[model samples]
Target: MEKLRIVFMGTPDFAVGILDTIYNSQFEIAAVITAPDKPAGRGQKVSVSAVKTYALEKNLPILQPTNLKNEEFLAELASYNANLQIVVAFRMLPEVVWKMPKLGTFNLHASLLPNYRGAAPINWAIINGETETGVTTFFIDDKIDTGAMILNKKIAIDSNENVGQLHDKLMHLGSETVIETLELIEKGNVTTTIQTENSELKTAYKLNKDNCKIDWTKSGIEIYNQIRGLCPYPAAWTYIKDGENEWNVKIYDSKYIEEAHTYSIGTIISGKKEMKIAVANGFIQIESLQFPGKNKMQIHELLNGTQISSEAFVK
Candidate 1:
């Protein structure tokens, strides 16, 4: 077998560890392709992608292609002479780019394939109250995450785990999986299982403001899952109202009490030091949260700054 030359593609912190592990391995990283830098925050300063930052520290060749199908970009990419391309936390690839490599393009996805096949897999897995979700490596196909599976490793989702915590676990696990996958591909010992489509399968749709809003009508368990699943990023939100005054609140951490409750859903129960929201058959005790124009703080701190009225409710 010939030596493998790899082109790694990814953005964000999730992909950084995998790239680092790959770099330390015996295989060659011919180049890295990440998203183009753009202005971010109030400063409008150009922001470098995490992958690019790592690549620069290692002095690995980098490509920031705004258009994957652009002729100039393709020519530059082809110059790398990489036989295999590894994608992690990257955008969908064009066939022209993915098909360029002879050993083929394989991706490290955050969820077990054929299940949470979309952008926000880790978030949806927990939000749907799934107790088990795992990482999978597969050869990229024409569709998203519908590729033939090369390898997978399952891990249990703790009852209290948030998406941020789950993400770290999967990332570390994915690093191990990626190295194993590289060895298999390099040694020509790879095998794959075709993914089957099932209508019953739950899809991981992209998170948006509309979908992230807290729907108090659901069971307390569901609302709890939703809050934890989106914690620390694109958080699950609701409006806390005291009479006509309303504040948009983002819930980060919460615990559920399953005792029977006669109060209407979305009703706020608050004392000087704590806050809980009424839901079907229970109350959700908020642990940490944030309001618009404010940083995340504990529920007690939220109460300390502003006293919620007895008539206050969340909707």
Candidate 2:
């Protein structure tokens, strides 16, 4: 097989591992394409993407294009003479870009194709109470995630696993799959499969504040899944009201209590070092949480620092 000249496109930490895998492989990495640097954090310091940082360390050729369709950017990309283009955790590509390479561009999606076919797949899978999820490698098509599948590897989700844990698991899994898919392409053994529609197809669109808010009116199990799905980043939140003051508090970890409860939904039940929120069928014992302007803390620690009155309830 010819030594594959590959160009990798991705951003964020999730995309870093896969790019690194390809970089270390026998295949030649012609260049890397990542997002442009932008100011981040309270201080607004310029921040580079994780892929870009790694590429710099390895001294690999890097491209940061603000516009994919720009003539200059497109010309620079085409100059790489890459046989294959690999995309992971990157923005939607234009047809001109994905079609430039001799071997069409392929993406490594966090979830199985035809299901959870959008952004935030890891978060949505857990939030929807799914017991299993997987990763897929597919050729890029005109529509997002509607491409022909090259391969897929299944993964079982732990009962209490959050998106953070699942994210890492899939990140590593995706790297292996990318390597396998590249091997197939190099050997001319690629067999693309068309994705079909599923009756229970659930799309994982972007997450917003409204969707991330904790709905205490839901069943304990449902609320538990939602909480775990969004934990660590962009955490599940609820409004905590104390007299005239009301504010949002992010809930990171929680345990579901399945016993019968008469307490109204959103009620804050607390002990000296414990905090629980009453939901439809029971309560969710808060394990870890964060208040505005405060670092994340254990339930006990938060109890000591904050005043959660008896009348406190999640909005």
For model 2, which pairs clash? none
User: Per-residue alpha-carbon lDDT of model 1 for 58-98, expressed as tens digits?
Assistant: 99999999999999999999999999999999999999999
**Most lDDT-accurate candidate:** 1
Clashes of 1: 0
Q: What's each prediction's clash count? A: 0, 0
Clashing residue pairs in candidate 1, if any?
none
lDDT of 2 by residue, 1-315 (tens): 756899999998999988888878888999999999999999999999999999999999999999999999999998989989999999999999999998889999999888999989999999999999999999999998989999999999999999999999999999999999999999999999999987888999899999999877788999999999998888999999878889888999999988787888888988879999888888899999988998899999988867788898888
Show where candidate 2 strays beyond 4 Å.
none
Question: TM-scores for all candidates?
Answer: 0.98, 0.98
User: Residue 130 lDDT in model 1?
Assistant: 97
The runs of at least 3 residues in candidate 1 whose Cα sits more than 4 Å from the true structure, single-residue gaps closed, are none
